[model samples]
Target chain A: MEVVIGTIAGILTSVSMIPQLIKVLKEKEVENLSWMMIAVLLTGVSLWVVYGIMREEWPIIISNAFSVMVNITLLIAYFLYKEK
Target chain B: MEVVIGTIAGILTSVSMIPQLIKVLKEKEVENLSWMMIAVLLTGVSLWVVYGIMREEWPIIISNAFSVMVNITLLIAYFLYKEK
Candidate 1:
């Protein structure tokens, strides 16, 4: 039950950026977005990954790994669009 | 060392939304913001608070508590400014 709750929470958090990512992709604009936020979030998520590894928590590791990927993608998109 | 890393991560993640919050407050606009993302994030953060409680992790609890407050404030701001 706890695992189930954690998994759901992980999925929700991991995908929370999808809408923003899609909007940025569609509009090719990031003027309203904050790169610092993304950077800090990426850093935090990375630490979560490390924490998970230390605790041997697979769910945390997996979810935050996915989150890290997502954040990196968003950061790339931000830079790419900002250059335009 | 691990605790230090986690604390810094917590601080970064907790305050990640500051820039966006400031931007929205200054502009009084949320046209580009995604409420769905905020909703999902709030849910996830709430779950993290639960998870932290279960694990007796004070950093997780405190940081996510702060995050929950920030997210809630952002949601309220979104609605208030969104109407303008």
Candidate 2:
């Protein structure tokens, strides 16, 4: 039951960003993307990692750590393709 | 310690979305926003709520539920502003 719930949570978190990812990819634009937004999200994700560590919640830690990578990649792409 | 951690977590989660929210608000555009993305995020938050309930984690439950409201508001705005 724990595994199932954790899996569901992970899926939900990972899949949630598909729209923004698709949009940025398709348009090759991120004029609307904000550095602060990305920073805050990264910070939040990092804190989640810390929270998981403090609590020893493997599910939260693993999923959020993975999410950090994905979000970082997106942010990098945002910077790379941003209108100059 | 738990309260502090939970409060930090809640703030992190809530503040994390500020960038997207600001961009959407300032641009008055959500052409890139995806319903699927919002749905997934909402689902994630909802699942988090359930997880909190199961675990009796008030912090997670309250924060996620609040996040659901904020995310729903954003999605509603996205739909409202989307080109018809």
Clashing pairs in model 1? none
| Residue-level lDDT tens digits of model 2 in B1-84 | 755764675587666766677788788887655678777888888888888888888877788888788788877878877855
Error at B24, model 2, angstroms: 1.5
True contacts kept of 2: 0.54
As for candidate 1, its interface RMSD to one decimal place is 1.9
What lDDT is reached at residue A84 by model 2? 50
Give the Cα error of residue B2 in candidate 2, in Å. Answer: 7.7
lDDT tens per residue, model 1, A1-84 = 666766776788889888878887788888767788889899988998898888888887888898898889989999998897
Root-mean-square deviation of every model: 2.0, 2.5
